[model samples]
Target: MSIERVEIAASPCPNDVFILSGLILNKVLTSFEYSFKFADIETLNELALKKAFPVIKVSFALYPEVYPDYQILSCGSALGFGVGPLLVSRKEIKELNFADFKVGIPGRYTTAYFLFKFFYPKEIQKIFLPYYEIIPALLRGDIDLGVLIHEGRFVYAKYGLFLVQDLGTYWEEKVNAPLPLGGFLVKRDFPEDKKNRILQDLRRSLKYAWAKKDEVYPLLKKYAQEPSQEVIFNHIQTYVNSYTLKLEGEALKGIKVFFETLNFKEDPENFIWENKDGIS
Candidate 1:
């Protein structure tokens, strides 16, 4: 029998590449066959809304729009303490007037954008750009402030950018829990058995990558924005955690609070897929 091919999509960030490297390279053993596609989180978010792929990585902020069609997998999540996006400026700026300053956001649907909106609450001029483009735009004076996510969080200081605020820290302090940035989403119509199987495979892939970090480093480096191995490892170390293996306790609570903060009425628990075979 021919192996069934399942389409998968995720960003090329170091952490994502590190976690999914095993699956991408067939290092993890799984009966299921997966085809991988790479894109920025924003484009993936748009594709996810159309159910373009059965499995995809998406920002937690985009969850509400795709919740009806997608159920979040327990594994492959990007959540942890001190792992939030940063709002940066080229130089030290004393006053932050929304009307006077223009902010560049990676994507409107990203958690970075959501956190900015949640905290600022004011209608500011936001220029949407790809994650990698934000820093360049800021450096060129295209925008007054930029919301930096992914690898940008690690290297902003090198660019002489001053950190105005750490959105992740604000979230943790306010919610008293770690922030859930993004996670894996599968179509709601996908078979539960297959979904559970895929979930287990994903957990196995994460384990494989962590155990064989050196082996996967090249693959991670291949897709990394920053060439430094230290930065790549730091990115992986920051985002991949126990929550990536399973969503429980404070991680689940944090997600609930985030949804509630956005005025989402549906029960957050209903959106998480519970693996009955003890995969979660």
Candidate 2:
């Protein structure tokens, strides 16, 4: 019997690398052969739009547009309180003059961009750059303000940047829930059995990482943009919480609120994949 091949794509962020490390390293056992691709979140979003990979990580803000073609997997999400993207500037500004400053966004399809637009919906001079490039561009004066995500969130202060806004905090205060940043999505047309298998193995992969942090740390560092042990440790701790293990209760509620705020008409339940036997 020929073992099937599965194509997976995700960001190189610590949380994602930590969670998928087991699968990538063959630490977790699965029947299918898995191939992995690592890229920035925005790039993953664009690839997801083209349905390039069978399983991919994507910004939750882009979910509505990719619906029907892809549905969310219950495991492996970067959703939590205090984990939202940060708006950073070179100098302190008491109040934002949207039209006066050129703002840098990670990507148009990113949840960071969505939250930024949701809270500060003004026509501003917006420049889209890779998430990793936003901070450097800000310091170089290429952009007036930049929204920082992933490991950028933890290291922006070291770059002498001022926090203009904590978009996650804003969303939390307004929605009263954790901010849904991104999650794993599987193609809707994929076989149900294979989907469930992938979901099961993904959960196992996460658990494997948690149980063997020392073993997984190297893998996280291998792919992380900011590989400092402190930053990598904090990244995993912040983004990979109870929600990463399973998306329910507050997690589900947060996503619902986000969709409602965006005026998305699709019910999240219809797109979230749940095991048929009611097993997580």
Candidate 3:
């Protein structure tokens, strides 16, 4: 059968660590029975979730767990980068005093939000909004603190937002591995054979990119909205790491600990390479 185009949606975060790899996956897998398309999910997790699943068919995810109707292909790598969510306060709200502030989250039910809750249950009073709005809302004083993701992770400091905590770093300290930032996932109905082929290609792409950082940087520059090649390259380098697809040992342990804290109650301490059998 002539392969149909496979669509992929990736988060807009510079630290995404998976999008370019997916793009490269497309490049490497061209000889296989597949063509590819990729999209950015802006900064809204819920919006991404709503538009992504079933329709996207296969999408990149930073947070673990899909709608239970989804199947995880493989975690690209243990992105050694985890800058824990910052609790950037507006104006004079110097330190995080949970009772006094309403933190803004990407979404109420997101894993990142739950991470906030699990670590700082006292901050349960925090507000949730579409990921994009949190920063502006914080600037407007509508929200006291913003729990940002994506590019916000890098540039929040420029917005005069103080990093109260680097959650990813915190996670690493707590669990001793790269925080489970994100990876590729597909709907249950995706053909198992195709999914496995795509999964292998994703890993291959990272290997290919790592060998040619100079080449990968151009790809990053191509997609990056930033004008300065130097700036964009630096940003991409800061988050992308050697652990992009190999989420085993410490990385898996880190993710397990993360879920445990959220009461997710399971320790998938190793990246299960195969998407479970009979996954429909």
RMSD of each: 1.2, 1.1, 4.8
Against the reference, the lDDT scores of all candidates come to 0.89, 0.90, 0.55
The parts of candidate 2 lying over 4 Å away from their true place are 278-280
Tell me how candidate 1 scores on lDDT: 0.89
Candidate 1 residue runs with Cα over 4 Å from true position: none
lDDT of 3 by residue, 14-117 (tens): 43433344454445644254333444433334444564543232222333445444554554532455545566677655555668677888766454565566
Q: Write the per-residue lDDT of candidate 2 for residues 37-151, one digit (tens) a residue.
A: 9999899999999999999999999998899799999999988899999998988889878678999999999999998997799898999999989988988999989999999
Q: Could you give the candidate ranking by lDDT, starting with the highest?
A: 2, 1, 3
Could you give candidate 1's per-residue lDDT for residues 142-165 as a string of tens digits?
Answer: 998999999999999998899998
lDDT (Cα, 0-100) at 16 in candidate 2: 92
**Model 1 backbone overlap count:** 0
Q: Between the candidate structures 2 and 3, which one is better when assessed by lDDT?
A: 2
Better of 2 and 3 by TM-score: 2
TM-score of each: 0.97, 0.97, 0.74
Cα lDDT, model 3, residue 112: 59
Residue 163 lDDT, candidate 2, scale 0-100: 93
